[model samples]
Target: MTSLLFVDDETKLLRILSSYFTKKGFVVHTASTGEEARSKLRDADARIIFLDLRLSDATGIELLQEFVPRYPNKLFVIMTAYSDVESAVTAMKAGAFDYVSKPAKMDELEIIIRRACEWLDMKQENRTLKEKISKMMQDQEMIGVSPAMKRVFRMVERAAETDATVLLEGESGTGKSRIARMIHRWSDRKNQPFVSVNCAALPEQLLESELFGYEKGAFTGAHAKRKGKFEAARNGTIFLDEIGEISLPLQAKLLQVVQEKSFMPLGSNQTVHVDVRIIAATNRDLKTMVEEGLFREDLYYRLNIIDIFIPPLRERKEDIPPLIEQFLDKQRAKYNKPFTLPPELIDRLVEYPWPGNVRELENAVERAVVLCRDEQLSIEDFPREIRHAKPDRPPSDIALDPTKSLPEQLESIEKKLILDALEQTGGQIAAAARLLSISRQRLMYKMNKYSIR
Candidate 1:
């Protein structure tokens, strides 16, 4: 049953109203002073408070103002004298549900309470709907049963335990960005902002400004001071997607942020410090870029503290069925056309090498959902490319390391030694650096270089 509270100095009215409401199946509470009423409001689960306009301690309007903003789910009805119409209007503006003049009929009071309950219920329902929509908008998740994904899951769990920089390396559209989100969601900073910037998507000029916020009037069109992703992700994680595509100058700024935990925004003189965890993802080989002098060595070392190499979807064929089912169900729900793929269609889909990876598979499923005439999707319903696609080669057929040169092999060995030393000493950088015969800063740079997280 819903609870109701009557806050009035009038002992006679409070007694009568309390008895009437209790008999009508409401759990009634009464308080004389404003202070007593406030205590009751906090302690009790009253949905509607029938508040007197004038109390011994304070006016009902004042109490209404204090509580309306704090407890929006609860309704406050002003019980005012006929001459206090102006005060009643003020109470309404301050978020009171309604006003009932003194000596009001029981029928009118009941109707007002009923209406307020309905409105509160509607607001709660609307909030629930919005939450569902938000989850749908950020619906991407990993779906795989392969050993490769099992390893990725273990890596995710390990990375979640600490606030280390993580680098997700994979082919384009292989769900590296989604895995970044998974890492953030599982980390200690999950409650804080998870800001992401795609280095390849923005121009060099704008990308620098977007990472570190600028002061007001720092640049043309800079009308107001705006906080960047770094500031916004305070005590949280900031994901840099397609990080390898970032310009060399911007990489220098990023290296400073990683090394010193500070950076000056574009067009700003003052340096802003931030304590944020970084998670960067890229398809490009940072080692190759570093060797070619296209990428900064220091920045590469800083970003590559903890590396998670995600195998492309084509390399994990065993995961295809579950991935297809998940995508099909999602697209069916989205398009309002629930359907199932035929056995032959499923076989063909699993055989077709997903060159675009998970992204391409999702598109294929959506396309099938939109064009299928019946509940059972056939080969003809799929895209032309998918229908005629060749089978993918086994993972064993491909190169395990993929780096074919002596320097690249040594680079791989050096990364392993650094990671092994860090692990043996439980992430004590100075000790790990000593074991690797490198300075502390050098080891730090090396860990960042290889992204040992």
Candidate 2:
């Protein structure tokens, strides 16, 4: 049933209106003073409140300001005498949903109540529709076709169906954050908040406060009580990015939350329980860190329940063309122009090792779009490193046999080039990556992709 509250100074009017609304199938509440109204509101959780412009202890405008921000979903109707129409207008400006002159007719009040209900219904429908559209947009934003990416997508779909703790391991700029958001959007708690925290970005103390929140006067500068990310996430998802960077001590605290789903805030002994779904991501290997005594084994095992490895862009070369096209489309729409890339430039981008993964490819596309003088983007539009990049081995330089298929021949050449680079650098990954014009992470990813090491 819908709830209606009337805050009026006159008991007789409140009684009459309450009786009328009760007959109209509303769970009605009445308060004769500001204090009484606040109490009734807390108890009733009214959907619509009829507040008098002149309360016994406080003005309706004062209450409206206090309630509007706190109860944005609730509607407030101001009541005033005909002579106090100006005051009603002020109350409306202060967040009153509507204003009715004193001696309000039953028919007029009924109409306003109906309109408010309709407004609320429409707002809810709009919010739901927006969430659907946002999820669809995010689904389209993930561009991938490689087998490695296909596996990631399959894992994501499976992970999203459950509440298992997900640990996304990948190189930096490999879109782990985007993958986390996708998992949240596809999960049962999509409608709830998705709070993200970069563990590497904050100090241990500040990170603790941010994750678990603090009570008022908890610390020297903690002047007000604040909810932590876990509290904010509540029944939704909390993404802990760069989880490997958190100190071992902090990991023990986090493990308590992961294992028990409860944590005490700073300066408070009260344990706050949360139904949050935990999703953590890291570029560093948590298992190795655990073995090295830099990370907690229990926490690592808890988070590793549903492990997902996001392949670097270098390992998923087939996904490059579509990723570039997606970035190009975004830039074209953003700039309101039709920009084109030549086939040669596209092939160059496809072959060049993207050290920074998808993120670098996106930046390069945007750069080309912004700097291109003409409709067609040229090689000169790219960064100096990309422009001057020489292929690891020319086709003629590599020994090719006529008996092998094109793909097989290409694979042979790629393997040889990597072996040559590794030998030249004396097995140093960083030096080999530099010689190959790729990132160290990308080089390692390629090695794993081809089982080179």
Q: Against the hidden reference, what TM-scores do the models get?
A: 0.56, 0.58
Per-residue lDDT of candidate 2, residues 1-453 (tens digit): 889999999999999999999999999999999999889888887999999978779988899999889898899999888788677667766877777777999987987788778778867865654564445456764767677876787688789999999999999989999889988988899999999999999999999999999999999999999999999999999999999999988999999999999999999999999999999999998878988999999999999999999998988888888788788888888888888888888888888888999999999988888888988899999999899998654455666589999998887877788889999866766457767876545777888878998
Judged by TM-score, which candidate is best? 2
lDDT of 1 by residue, 195-273 (tens): 9898899998888888898888988999998889899888999999999998888888889988888988767888889
Query: In candidate 2, how many Å is residue 121 off?
Result: 44
lDDT: which candidate is best? 2
> Which runs of model 1 end up more than 4 angstroms from their true locations?
1-140, 392-453
Each prediction's total of clashing residue pairs, residues at least 3 apart in sequence or on different chains, is: 10, 0
Q: Which stretches of candidate 2 lie over 4 Å from their true place?
A: 1-140, 394-453
lDDT of 1: 0.83
